[model samples]
Target: MRIYKVGGAVRDRLLGKPVTDIDWVVVGTTTEEMLAKGFRPVGADFPVFLHPKSGEEYALARTERKSGRGYGGFTFHASPEVTLEEDLIRRDLTINAMAEDDQQNLTDPYHGQRDLEARVLRHVSPAFAEDPLRVLRVARFAARYAELGFNVAPETLELMRQLSESGELEALTAERSWKEISRALMEDQPQVFLEVLRACGALRVLMPEVDALFGVPQPEAHHPEIDTGVHTLSVLEQAARHEQPLTVRWACLLHDLGKGLTPEEEWPRHIAHEFNGLKLIKAVNERFKAPRDCQELALLVGEYHTHGHRALELKPSTLLELLQSFDVYRRPQRFEEFIAACEMDARGRKGLEQRSYPQADYLRGAATAARSVAVQPLLEKGFKGPELGEAIKRERLKALKVYKEST
Candidate 1:
């Protein structure tokens, strides 16, 4: 049997990138032969094994044919006769279809190296359309390598468009879609992933609320980009550029869903879009069953981002109300996350990316000042129950007032 390194390991190495994991394809090998050689069987759907010593994945070279619908509708064929080239061709992208031999000799039956050099994300074969998941995979690759100037090949994009229109995208499970989306959100250019999906029409099927924002106009004075969807992407880009964590980025992504629901006659003025966005954010969170932290932050940003923008102009009582709304003493980090997402939203507009957002510091200082109010002193003053709560609020409000005056 001849074993060759395949898939991401070979592709990453060819691109002069660090290879994180290696997958081996064993050609001219049978399942019985592999079992005899001390490899543990692990693949439920096909012939995959874990090497006894290295513990890396090793699959017998196999080929599959579409037998039904969605990702599960496939029949696999693996045997000693299955060639390495056949296995490679089953990959989703040309850049990922290259393999390398034990002697480090490269195999390029599909010219993956050429596509990689050209910075093109091309599908390996027509079979790429067979699996609906490839649409998300292609978009994800667009996000991952966007900094390196990689773009989706026209033909591949057309295939994605066809899949999107065929309703095949709808057949994907929400969990699978979320896996792609969450990973894409953490990419260096997460907006590109959404943009590519939107371009291919998959956004309507997967994230219709986000898709609805595309033609929706925002107040031009506030959002020079005009289009709510464009502004959303801009905010997501800013979030990434700021190196914000995934929770903050996720909040940035869903913060403006309310704008999409604004009445067209209202045009650019979405007076209550902040509150309007709350239900949409909750819907997205429930659809994907997103992490509780991500859901909470998105909800908080959706409801209070406008308050965050107007933080510096608020009265002390209003400022205290906002700070209390976050329950900052219990989860101060969430307050920081909320500020980061709001900063991204404010900076997301055209020509405002580098502008200062003092509101963040203002709110942060307000939170700190309120936290510094002594609860022990209030209790020692013979306060209890509702009176204790009332006294603490009064003290925190006073502290906020002092902070506001100092500023």
Candidate 2:
């Protein structure tokens, strides 16, 4: 058996990036050969083994044929006869299809190295359309390499559009789709992920709530971008620029979804879009099987992001209520994420990216003041039961009042 370092490790290495993990493709190997050589058999759908020493995955060189619909509807053939070239042709992108031999020699049967040097994300074969999941994967790769000036080949995007129109994207599993989306959100140009998806019409199938925002108008006075969809993408871009955590990025992405639900007569003014957006955010969570933390933060941001922007104008009682709504005392980290999401929204408008968001600092101060209303002091005062809860609330409200007055 011959081992070749393959996939992301080889691709990243060629791009002069620090390889995080190494995957190996074994040629001229059978399952019995791997097991006899001390490799642990681990694959479920195909022949994959774990290295006895390094613990890295070693998948036997295999070929796949589309037998039905969706990504899962594929037949795999892994035999000692399968060539390395046959395996590489099955990959989604040209940049990811190349493999490196143990002697560090490159194998480019599909011209992956050429596409990588050209900064293009091209499909390895026409069979790219066979897997609906490749649409999301291609968009994710665009997001990952966007900072490096890489773009999806126009032909690849056209193929994605065909896949989208074929209604195959709807067959993708929620967990699988979320994996690509969350990873894309963490990339350097997360907005490009949405843009590419939208360009190919996959966004409408996978996330209609977000897709609805594209043509929806927002108050141009506040959002120089004018389009709610554009504004949302801007928010995601801002979150990525800050290198915010996944929770914050998710919140930013869903924050303006309500604007799409506004009455058309209302046009530019989405008076209660925050409250209107809560249902859409919840629907997105339900569709994607989003994590509780992501759904909770998105819900909070959807329902209260406007309150954050109007923080200075809100009554002291309202400020305390907002802080209480987020359970800031117990989950201060989440509250921080909420503020960061709101700040990203405020700065996401066209030509305002560098503008200051004093609301963040103001809310932070309010939270600090509210938390400073020590529960120890109330406990020492013999407060207990329902009355204790009321007492703590009163103290927090009072402290928040003082903070509000100072601000």
Best by lDDT: 1
lDDT of 2 by residue, 1-407 (tens): 88898989999999999999898999998999899999998858879989899898999999999998887999999999999999999999988898988789999898888998999999999999999999999999999999899998999999999999998988888999899999999999999999999999999999999999988987778888999999999999999999899999999999988888888998988988888899999999999998999999999999998899998899989998999899998999999999999999999999999999888899999999998987888899899999999999999888988888887
Clashing pairs in 1: none
Worst 10 residues of 2 by lDDT: 40-49
Model 1 C-alpha lDDT per residue in residues 327-403, reported as the tens digit of each score: 99899999999999999999999999999999989989999999998888878889999999999999998898899
What TM-score quantifies how close candidate 2 is to the native fold? 0.97
TM-score, one value per model: 0.96, 0.97
